[model samples]
Target: MTRILAAALSSALLLASASAETLKDTLPHISVTGEASEEALPDRAILHLDIVADRLTATEAVTENERKTRSLSDGLVRQGVPIDDIRVVGVTLQSVATEEAAPRGAHGKHVSRGFRARSELSVTVNSLDEAASLLSRAIDAGSNDLRGVEFVVSDERTRLERLRIAAVKDAEQRARNYVEAVGAKLGRIIEIDHQEAVSATEANGRTEPLASASGVAFLRLRPGVRRLTARVSATWALSR
Candidate 1:
């Protein structure tokens, strides 16, 4: 009986020591989240313009729409804009009922009067100086539907990489501060996770039609500052 009791007590002691070691291994790390933002003026401009035409038949409407789009494209090219930067993004053709077509019929049936055709174009201008002139020329070329305008940096990828580094540095600094406050020194990074970058524009709103007298003033419509933010969550090993 004494021998059996001694063996059981020894096994229990070894199990307790193993559990204590596992707890220590899991609790010796620190984690923190950090975020940072950078702002820069946009160097590129993207303009959205549309051409709409209505005619007695679908074929006539489509032909007119194509003619107007061609005119707009040629006008931009004449002003030294690159042909590769201009692209047709959307096209639509649908029959529209005019008042004349809605006249009461013997069988109370509605007739289709004409068809409307619309074409949307997306233009990317590298130089801010040419943004206003390009838009004005497109409007003069029969592009009456001005949809929207967006400003962006052509080299945003490089800027975002720099912000990522800054965010990691910011996290390290915070971890060090916390470790120091607890009377310990910072150690190697055990784990790291980078969050997606959030991008925002300072004045991202639809622009109104340019006044006939304010052609040059359109250049003053500057693409305000663009802000890019980065966040990171990092875990570092703790050291005494």
Candidate 2:
């Protein structure tokens, strides 16, 4: 009976030691987040325009849209816009007006066959000076629809890479400061988490239509600065 009791006590001691080790390994650590921002001039601008035509039948609508699109393309080519930069993004033919149902006492009304066809093209203009003129010419050439324009930098990948490195360094410095303040030492890095960066236009000016025959308005293309932000959360072990 004495030998059996000794063996049971030893097993219980070993189990307790293992559980303590596991708890120590799974302890939570401190995590800190840091952010960095940089601003630079945008290098490119994207213009979105649409050509639309309505007719009694789909065939007529499509035909008229094709003619208008061709004319717009020609005008862009004359303005030195490259063919590769121009892409047809969307094409659709849909009913402009739906048939309305009659009252309970009246018969159902016949639906009209009127249809409108639209062709949308995305154009990338490297030169800001020509943007207004190009738009005006396209409008004169029969492009009735004009969508808002968006500006962007072509070398965004390079800018983001630099910002990421700066953000990581900033996060490390912040962690060090926190550890020093607490009178503790920072140990090995346990984990790292990164958030998606955002870029946007902080300011913009109102646009006014220009009186030009080319359907192009005189635009004031002010290339504004784009802000790139990067955030990182770092977890570091703390030691006393």
Candidate 3:
């Protein structure tokens, strides 16, 4: 019985290996990667603000924080910012000593600032020219921390499609370069896969990891130029 079982296992292994060999590509092929990018001025500005309050008691801190948020919202509404455009994405309360209240290295050992309340605010401001002024106004309306503004394109679907096409063309060119160098001909593409899309605000293509094709990344998007980068991996048959 043991010998019979061993024979069956050996046969199964041989059959599986044969199946894998049959599926393996025997044709000569080349694999290459391509990348491309395009830049445009961001069309929208999203402001990030933090309203924070510290007091002897948690209730007092929370109440003060709430008042500041209301003041900020009302001020923006008065400046023609729509109510729907202002959002409070997060809120938190904690007992800790902040750096501003401490003197250098004194982290929380001897200094206590009491309970702190914070509200994270996200505001959409459409006018680029008004961004600087909006920050000033937000401060006066009770924002304690200016986290910075995110500039984005309202719609990027059309632009991203262009980047992808360019990336594929770039891959083909690279494949051709190698084939021509070797005195060979480039044949039809066997497989193509979209690898990555980096939507960055700056030139370095570093910042946030974009979500699929539309994820957000912070790059050098300085005031005028934002970059959208795409990459593709592809395989092509080598023509004889």
| Tens digit of per-residue lDDT, candidate 1, span 176-227 | 9999999998776766778756455656733444545754334334666778
Q: What TM-score against the true fold does each predicted structure earn?
A: 0.75, 0.75, 0.67
lDDT scores for all predictions? 0.80, 0.78, 0.77
- Winning candidate number (lDDT): 1
Alpha-carbon runs more than 4 Å astray in model 2: 1-28, 98-113, 199-205, 208-217
Q: Comparing candidate 2 with candidate 3, which one achieves the higher TM-score?
A: 2
Q: What range of 10 consecutive residues in model 1 has the weakest lDDT sum?
A: 98-107
> Can you tell me which runs of candidate 3 are displaced by over 4 Å?
1-24, 96-113, 180-188, 196-224
| Candidate 1 residue pairs that clash | none
Comparison by lDDT, 1 against 2, better one = 1
lDDT of 2 by residue, 133-203 (tens): 67666777777877867677777778777777788899989998988898987787766667646566655
The per-residue C-alpha lDDT of model 1 at residue 100 equals 35
